[model samples]
Target: MNKIYTGILSAVCLDGSPPAYHYAKGFGEGASNWMVYLEGGGWCKSEDTCYSKVQNQGPGMGNSYKKGNQTAFDGILSPSQTMNPNVKIHRRGARVFKAIMEDLLAKGMRNANNAILAGNSAGGLATILHCDGFRALIPNAARLKCIADAALFIRGKDLPGAADKRELSFATIVAFHGIDNFLPKSCTSKMDPGLCIFPENLLGDIQTPIFLLNSAFDSLQVSSCFFQNLLLELNSYILCIHFRTTLLKTIPEDHSSSRGIFIDSCYYHDQIYFNPKWIGPTSPKLNNKTMSEAVGDWYFDRSSFQEIDMENDFPRDCTRDT
Candidate 1:
């Protein structure tokens, strides 16, 4: 696999270090295939600092800190724990995401036979926002696949050129969201006002297969439900599965629950708002079994999915028209 680094608005500061990308060797090893992962949050300077601030703020502020210094919490009913210490935390910023995508394309990722875009939380939103650019940069034969965990509820209008860019017309689009959290600030001005207008604008044009996940016990689940409702109403070709039951609740009590999975500590005040039962999974499979499994399967096998015909379903520049 070929790898390249694209600079975002500025360099990402993770644990006080610059951001970097790891392109796994595969696509070029056999047949060409590509997979990209995005993370959630409002573009923190560094992973450690981001977590430290959350810890300082306390649990309820959306930054849950497990006792073990884990950055992520398990999706199970147990108390939240620390993320993998060895795992490299990338800067979660929109510009960083754009740079990554651009870098991948520059490295010939766009020419692959298959492509997959995956992310948790804000990263998921970034994938959706950057899909159009991927389409423009890659060859037509390259299949596009998306795996969004606790994602969706994003509005295309919020993106830089969402007004003019087309909704991501991928072969498959899968999304997941917690039942307790609300849409991120990027999605709306306030939590109560309702759905972001951006998702509405692109709903009709999305032709990929969509999978939805939510827990009944989670507050964010309500927002996921609202998102599902809008997609269904738009007569979209989305496949949604909602988990009304959950054994655990996510921690760090903020809108970007999954995004804060890498912090080492939480502020005392934030702890009051955190749900101890929310823990990060030991493996990606355990995080959210259904979504993780589906994503893995999609990433390897492109033949199982079908691509969208952009000309008929989506407007050339719906973002601008909306």
Candidate 2:
């Protein structure tokens, strides 16, 4: 955590504020095991969006100046040995990723025996994007894997010939962030770098094992509508069904046997490490295992979880009150 400066690495935020992170060294038997979590705060596809974000949120999301000096660690990143173990920023996120890992290696991640790179939403996409590169960074580590939670933003036709807003947004983000160079060459070599940002386009080539925790009816990608016209509402419902089907089919057939999938029919976005959604009874379950249980089982090689919620065609409310 020392001897590395944001100014030296130029890993500053969009507003040029210094980047920051909350890290707790693992203790007891879990020492030498590392979990690198990339916090997701969506993306800024254009200059206007970025500007609007700055206006509304100050530099909190894009700058470390507003971030708390210490963040509470719970769930997977928790220091509780009995419960279990593990565990931000910028359009300059790619740069920040590199700098953080460099610092962690200097701080002892280089000695890591087991490592998991996990992220949610946009950060989950980042996990998939950088999985292989992260593996290469620690070749000596005995075990390394990645997890992408609710980041499987697919590219597909909403209607017969409708333009995909998600894909267009990604293209704009590429142009806005100038992050084309950071995209995986395996994907870029085959098509436009902008298309490569989609996880579906890049998953086929990823060497590192990855576990995907997502929802068939992802709340972010699919929205609820209150239409007065019955026909319009019916049309919207049909589109939702098509979207769900497209997402299911887009996930590869798991030919390599290295992918761990858990796509429930929940109306949630990011559901990785939060206590209730992660491990409690109210948490959405597939094959009798909660998200946290499934992830732990996959990470430790206890079992391979690759089940989709075929029963529910609609998104079920799985959020907990607490």
Question: Which prediction has the highest TM-score against the true structure?
Answer: 2
Question: What's the count of clashing pairs in each model shown?
Answer: 46, 0
Superposed model 2: Cα runs more than 4 Å off: 1-4, 58-91, 158-164, 224-236, 320-322
lDDT for each residue of candidate 2 in 204-321, tens digit (9 for 90 to 100): 8888999999988777776621112332456566666777898887787775547899999887788886777887767888998888888888888888888888998776788654
Give the alpha carbon lDDT tens digit for every residue of 168-242 in model 1.
211012111121123344444443223332333232333343222222222232223234344336644221122
lDDT of 2 at 41: 78
Spell out the clash pairs found in candidate 2.
Answer: none
